[model samples]
Target: AGSSGSRGPSPLTIGMADTIPLAVAFHEIIHSYFRGTEESKCQVKMSGDMMLSFPTGIVGVLANNPNPAKLCFRLKNIHRLDNVLPNKQLISINTMMSTRDTTVVDFNMPALTALLRRQSEKNPTAQYFNVDILKYQIRPKAGAASCPFQLVAYWKCEQDHTDLKVDYKYNLHAMSPPSPLLNVSVCVPMNGEVKNVIAMPKNIWNGENEQALWRFTELSQHSDDRGVGSLRARFELDKGPSSKGTISAQFNCEGATLSGIEFELVGSGYRLSLVKRRFVSGKYICDSEVH
Candidate 1:
């Protein structure tokens, strides 16, 4: 699809025109897996990340175009990029940030023309493109965000009967779109082990001799069914009320960052495919001492 004008190379030119020699060679880059029968769409991977405490934390997003990418490309700028073409050249990376939609970064870097020619001539296949959009700090005392997540638990023990209940919720306000949490898990460290225990939702169970666990495929206000989630368990202890130990939990959520952001590129002649975004944490806890 060569046309009048500068005859410059551009992202919109990568695999966009069947008539172009380079575009015709890598026509398969846009496989069915990327998008059904329809090709010519830019495929990008997107995800969000949040690392912090109630007092302060960092949130960011990662976008990547996988390997087998010499023919493929990504956007440039902001985050660390590798194995991909420069934004104005052969590769492109989509950046993600955790600020509100109001304070997003601008993606207007000039010299974006004539990149495809060099990328195609030198390397036919290489690493994909990925960009980290925007990342910033959030101070609750400054009125940026309140509590990000919350957990409540109660444990009681009698001679032959022991009862435990836990309730959990995440502050939707912290997330712009209030995305749901993924791989959610709740655990309570206990003293003794017990079989034939009773779990309210049936998904909750006893683990080892010192812990009980409850897992959810996805946790959110809408997915909670009741607007909130509550898990309970009843079991008998071999020894009397020894100790309830400590309770710990962890989870990950993809989609939007704490800032609640969105992005777009204009006049690039490139069509950004569907974005894969997410937010995750290794270990997290909510208590009076920690927010």
Candidate 2:
């Protein structure tokens, strides 16, 4: 019995040998990844906002290249690109062509807007390009979710419509899975002296910047969309509100990026180690009609 068993130690020994190699291999892989360097990192981020002009099918989009390094981005479901501007330095027209229902644009390093380029002096920190990916759409499609929320806002102003009784109401719908913005704050520029202030769901005031600031604290810490938030206020304006005065807001979500654009590294010998994307609100004007 002992001589027969000596041929091989046991089945347990064989299993241990096989398991050891796999565990060691995984450990080394993780160790090398966490020990990465700057050059080893290859990532892309996209930041932009969506402008919704009510009573119209069009939606305005403003996008800026995320990385400082010269990179190419393939934007899916976008209406158009900034090709007619005649700036070859910021956008590489030759390579950014795609036949599919997608727009590809190569953003050059240190990309500068036309307004910035015209000036003799330029700010290095403010280097960016303005590309209206979706200036207009025939009808807002289902996947057009660059903006996180589908905001339904209403304005009820008397005939005076200025320096008198004014009212504003808004309802923010998450639109997609990136629901419940962690920190939601809507800023409405008073454009005059704001008084007789009143707000719904608490937390609202007239800031020193001459704007009515409404912060949705409960919604900010929400697990899901809380349905709606409303506010009512009366202001004694020294001057009528500016025509350009519109509602601007901040919707920060830890779940997903607001832009709805995804990135993937498509080359060999390089793994997409990490990706970070952020979409901050620029102009969140809500109106009943596109004026």
Candidate 3:
């Protein structure tokens, strides 16, 4: 056995499955142990050897906003294999939007691969292997309003000469419980300056680069204790009418995956260990209409 050189708490432990001891052992060791002469001995050895040791788990979150419809997906590999890399691994993503209207626009896998390649190239001692998988993207003709859980924005502006009063209304609805933190960023036009901002249920607000950032924590399915979880924000702009600026948002919810991805072990002879993956939304944006 080799040390994985991991620093934190060990995620692996020994337990009993039925009457058998579920212990971690290398593939070669299991194969050698099962090599026997008698039929009964071979059967016993094979049964014991069937237990494979591998680490598998994933944690992720997905976020979206509806000003300039966009999506950002991020994932992490939580498997705890010390020195061994799987022979084959594949990650597949499927969007739940209506196949007729929505399409994937940008996927970051190519950029990620290029980054990894650059790092490996810079460090000659570092070994790298590309996973075999097909990446995809889609474009929605009507934006992300059709998503199961989405944020929709509408703007109203009244202009009196050079002065303007703008009211922003935002609605966030979810069919299922999503991540607890909802991040909203609204871009302010160059000709306009934000005068005041207010949100129901009280949230944190920060301004940078002519954009306002609103953060809502501990969000539930309803906005209040008595109603379904939703959010609304109104912003007042001065100097000019509100322009249709980009609105982007992000959040992480458990038990929901944007891309229905699955993992399987290939050329490993058997299901030697567990392999898990998770997908979450990152920086999802949608277009808004200002009237």
The prediction achieving the highest TM-score against the true structure is: 1
Backbone Cα, N, C clashes tallied per candidate: 25, 0, 31
Off by over 4 Å in 1: 1-124, 131-135, 141-149, 158-161, 204-209, 264-275, 286-291
Q: Order of candidates by lDDT, top first? A: 1, 2, 3
Q: What does the lDDT read for residue 135 in candidate 2?
A: 23
lDDT of 3: 0.31
Candidate closer to the true structure by TM-score (higher is better), 2 or 3: 2
* Distance from true location, Cα of 229 in model 3, Å: 5.0
The CA root-mean-square deviation of candidate 3, after full C-alpha superposition on the true structure, stands at: 21.2
Give, for candidate 2, the lowest lDDT window spanning 10 residues.
Answer: 22-31
lDDT per residue (tens digit) for residues 1-291 in model 3 = 111332222223222221111112211110111111121221101000111221211000011111211212222221211222222222223345213222222224344334344544575443222222233221111233213334444445544112212222222332112323233333333235666667554444454555545554534445454223434556556665656554555444333322322222322112212222212344344344422
**How many backbone collisions does model 2 have?**
0
Q: In model 3, which regions exceed 4 Å deviation?
A: 1-148, 160-191, 203-208, 218-230, 234-238, 252-256, 264-268
Worst 10-residue stretch by lDDT in candidate 3?
Answer: 56-65
Q: Which ten residues in a row have the lowest lDDT in candidate 1?
A: 53-62
Model 3 TM-score is: 0.40
Per-candidate Cα lDDT values, in order, are 0.40, 0.35, 0.31
lDDT of 2 at 73: 44
